[model samples]
Target: MPEKLTNIRNFSIIAHIDHGKSTLADRFLLHTKTIEERTFHDQVLDAMDLERERGITIKSHPVRMHYDADDGRTYVFNLIDTPGHVDFSYEVSRSLAACEGAILLIDAAQGVQAQTLANANLALHQKLTIIPVINKIDLPAADVDMCLEQVEELLAIPRDEVLKVSAKSGMGVKELLEAVVARVPPPETDPAQPLQALVFDSVYDVYRGVVSFVRVVNGSVKVGESIRFFNTDLTTEVKEVGYFSPGMKPSASLLQGEVGYIITTIKTPGDIHVGDTITGYLRACKQPLAGFQHVRPMVFSGIYPIDTADYEALKANIAKLRLNDSAFVAQPESSIALGAGFRCGFLGLLHMEIVQERLRREYNMELLLTYPSVIYHVFMRDGSMKEVDNPLHMPDPSHISHVEEPMIKSQIIAPATYLGAIMNLVMDKRGICLKTDNVDHIHVMITARLPLHEIVLDFYDKLKTVTRGYGSMDYEPDGYETSPTVKLEILVNSEPVDAFASIVHADRAVYRARMICERLREAIPPQMFKVAIQGAVGGRIIAREDVRQLRKNVLAKCYGGDITRKRKLLDKQKEGKKRMKEVGNVNIPPEAFVAVLRASDDKG
Candidate 1:
């Protein structure tokens, strides 16, 4: 029994974006013959259409491969390929927890990036063995020596241990797999103990219900056995047990130290939570496994359907999507301007964009999104605290004591020549430079602290622009600090639009207000009466723009009329315009809201 566990090597591949993690995963499957030659393609693990089109791994993919080692021994390898973007760091962490070691890949051309360091630290914190590898040696700009030196100097790893491989060309991958078997220790678990499995990922199937991807730490789980989730305390009979041979392959049982999925007949998507432990229903473990920390959403926005009748359908679609993405959250909410919709929260801007795109493409739902905002802690004068993510829920000025905003400690890597520009860009976002380190002759790393609200928009895009697409950024949440913030409300013809309300810092409120007003002026068409687009902070107008009213020219037929007649007609027209202004309803087009959001992204 112990010998079986000794032959199992579980590890994951982690790296920065575009560093060839998925390509490397494909190579492994091909080399091991886990996939047929006729069925082989690029990025075989990325099954989603959106992921293939974007060329990024949005979800972590796991597969089991059996490799015949040079020592004439057969070994089973459990490989997990993870996403490299900052927003998907949670996915990477969960994947790391299921493995015994991690392959840290660095692009030969782009030596060490911000996310590269961040992911390395996460693995170090978890105490997983790290294998440094240099990828993309086939590129013309590959600097293998510089990357190896940087790995030693910056990552504090020995240069001799680092491996060089071209994932695209499948060079040296065999040796890399051999190294994994030699270096990465096998899982230490006892088959005689009670069932204790960690749920790292899960998905909902129409026919099978909830299929949980788990790593069994102790004992074995099989069909017809009753299991209970440690977190939710929900019990259900295991319908089937299986392993991923790049696809589902049902097995008799998942033994100790093996990675596989379990089909629970539970149809509710929210019943099975990620990071929950699965144990025997009759014989439970004394203590639950140390699961992952709860994910806190960093950004919030309203997702309304263009057609109101799709509310129930949209809700069901979101529930299905959330089954795969545990980080994306949603709650039913109504807006005075946008009507019934769902208020969704995401990890970052990119995550939000992907979810919106998924809904549009996967479910065929047309959506209207409002401006994104971060959660703010509002301390009321009555000795109470409230967490506000929606601007419409902000308490009155007299009842509020102070506001605390979320901050982040960001790590940015860029070329040395663009250091000045990067510094200025950080400063513009109301951030303070903490320190700067020279990574090499050409690359520099800068650490800074910035308000979460400032970078929730286009900060990353700006950083890339200044660094000429050579910059990368990673951030961690810092505790909130007391900041003077005001609720900026957009009033169209004196009627407040709840969807257009936002919380802004007092000092920059005027500039942000001006941007919104200008965009609205351009987007809104001329009305029958004069329309006023005003940005107000606590009832005080800070920015204003007017849309000129359309005139029918009441005097067009008065070619040669008396002066009194002309005056009478003009006075009558003025009285009619005044009445129209009082009762007229401004039909704001959906495009106007889109324009305002686009403008806010530039100035947020």
Candidate 2:
């Protein structure tokens, strides 16, 4: 290898949540003295307050460090920190595409987990060099031998090659770093080639325009260079080129095999794509690098402003958020009951929640989200197939031939003792167990196929409940399967509430309808006239709940009135009440929608 390429190593840490990926990165920053001890903090790479508060890495952060090895040589290490949640696996994949190697970190106490296996397979699929490392070895329950056996059995890596380290206590960290230097190979590319930098991520800057994080695969990019995005064919001038000192440290240029950022003149939200390739305008690469796959959101919901007048503000906020997150998709969709809103799609339930929280916190916008739904492939009798994510878009039952819902192949790792409970939980979610394998003496791995709709709700919470918080699950799309489904709509005073409608499985529709109706009964305030909340499938009503009217005492002060007069007064009051009921519209509060969403997550 040439001296220039041999001194630079690009690698990322891949692991399940809470497996100390961020902590390990922190240790790397400290050991290399990238930051002074007095200025350092835990989870240094997790810059977002939400990330620090949640104790999870939501975004993949890259930083460069100069380390002095025991061999009396200095090397440049580019470490990309990635999120562990399945929803952000796209972030993991993008970060991995920019790296030449990955540190496959496993929790010593938890051993091999579902996501552990998932991330390992991703790295393997990318053909990247994997360094198996056991983390948290200082814990009392750390079973090094069991973890080693599981890694060898599941990941097919030899036990002798695995390194053990305590990221929290800094034990064996130095040796682990040495192993990374020795095991992970250097980037192999020629600087003489045409400029072909892969854009892994980008964030919209109010002042600097779009700041794109890129990995220069070949040639180089510097300030004042005009570049074109291969995906969109949009040309822009580079305003600044810098590498992350963990902070933006401007450099003269970004060279080949280096990970850095390039600030462009473009200010639009959707101009530069995350996985797009950047090439010089006059002299471009013949072909763009193989970028990451485009993200397909699995869950869809309606996001509306709590205050109708905030619609414009909400739209701007969502667009800004989308600039940071390409996976989160939104389009203008209005609901009669909820007014103007956006139909937003998310990778999963957690991803939806995180986006909501970010909007509320960062943008200070009060938002309302409808019941989440998955895209269904509806095959019509005329041999036409239509994709439906919103219940409002569902065709009439008579026009539909069959409905096919998305399915997922799920992997669950749990204690062997919880097998029966876990199996029963899966069964309740309309899942079929395919096979099971023992990871060690006490832990077992279970693979199952389940409808995506069933698990979208409270499946994860229920799995944790049944397994006593010992079970972890990871899943991937497994195409679609024909299923009996219907559009379930909630009607308030005989008027359909578009925001509360959903496409539910026929077998579970009745249960889900009843749950939502009950929640509405509790949430909707009583009016002068009675309000009826009904859940209906097409024209048939399946569940109903009535909000009792607040009756007024018309005869309270008629103690001395004649019987006929009193009777006349009572009749007049009845007429007034009837008139109010006929003309009045039910007002569904924000809390009512929130209650219905909470109820929608109940196991059906």
Candidate 3:
């Protein structure tokens, strides 16, 4: 039987990256005896190998736990563990929307970082009760008092009300569980109302089809019932209804205010979307629940199989991956240099990296990724607008009036010692400083508006370098601004290599061109004839480099022969080079294209 609505507590844990969010979830699982001590491992909720290796959660994982509260009653707790990185903020928002409260985890030694402020604001915006907790207190360098003060000052939460727990050592976990039961209110729902379940997340299993993870808000759903998706308007019979006991366990029905998974046996992944409302077919909901806002991709890149034979396999894998990751978008695109591929859009740089890594590791495929870019709105001379997500799709500069690049509101939190370096770096990236706040005597937060393209390329790595790894950053889309931009095209031996072309600010085009040309010079091997690598904007060349021919001296065999013989050999060699330059096509290695993406490594 389903537990009483009053006994169900649905909540999530939100925190900055590497702030012990997963570790805390592990403690909760152990405290409630959800898993045997012998079977328990580190970061049990982070099932993905990538998440474990990176020490961060990429996807939000939901698990149901049963706790015996101090009030002499058993309570059902649904814990949604959310990703901490800014790229996964949309996932965090959806998880928060499905919860009644959120546990704000902060690292005691690190204090409040940029993502902490961003996620806290998200929880407050959703009207969920915020419970601040300072984790990792067992460390020798842990500064609990300082973190507490930062939380109070930044989040406006009371100091005394904040809880303390060391998730690693299991200290104060029992009390923390009790506080959850007492402080976090149970879900509010009306069983008499029509069925309306919020689909927060979903996954596609080869055996079971689409399994939607939902939080039932009103009414109830049972097996063999006909359900309709509010947005898609597609109806299907429920194959199964179940709750997550860390893993899926079949249940007869899911009543109001409960969290569980639903198996609809729907094959097409697009039919069931995250944030869609599910209702009974017979008595459908008149108004669907307030679904989440559609997430837009902030970074774009081209992914192609190293061998064209795997093109179909790559496409199929991407379709399957999209069944679980809705934020990823891919469209078929063809490149003269890279062959058939897909132009993919991502939330951020890390998100792009994660997807690429998954394609390689999970799907066991060899792939080539083009340089990442941001979408640009090209205003044409004919008063028409074209959105360019890939540099290859960039319109000719002569036919375009101007280009508008996406901008973002960036926030950086770091030690006060690196404030000058951080400011300098931001200004160099064409960022406008909005404001800066001193969290305490030791920590500071900087807010700025920067072009999305700048951040997509090596900004995070540079930030960590300047701040000595003590800094953290978060950003959100801040619309777009018109800018003077041009397409920088790379030509090898007078032939345009579309893979190396990029859209850059006009002011920085010359510098970027020079950098890419120099990189290509090192990446391209010497050929029989000199290859001129030029970076051009429309009809004008801005930067150039030449890979000198590999000289095989035919004249070396002359030895002490007369000057006439040597002259003949030299003339023949020169003619051969001239002919080669006219007809020889440069064969650029795949690594050359990859090197172009990292051309700014030293400079950045």
**What residue pairs are clashing in model 1?**
none
lDDT of 2 by residue, 334-392 (tens): 99988999999999978998999999999999888888889999999999999999998
- Poorly placed runs, candidate 3 (over 4 Å): 1-3, 557-569, 598-604
- Position 285, candidate 2: lDDT: 88
lDDT of 1 by residue, 226-257 (tens): 99999888999999999999999999999989
Candidate number with greatest TM-score? 1
Model 3's TM-score against the true structure: 0.96
The TM-score of predicted model 1 comes to 0.97
Off by over 4 Å in 2: 190-192, 552-576
Q: Global lDDT of each model?
A: 0.90, 0.89, 0.89
Worst 10 residues of 2 by lDDT: 595-604
What is the lDDT ranking, best to worst? 1, 2, 3
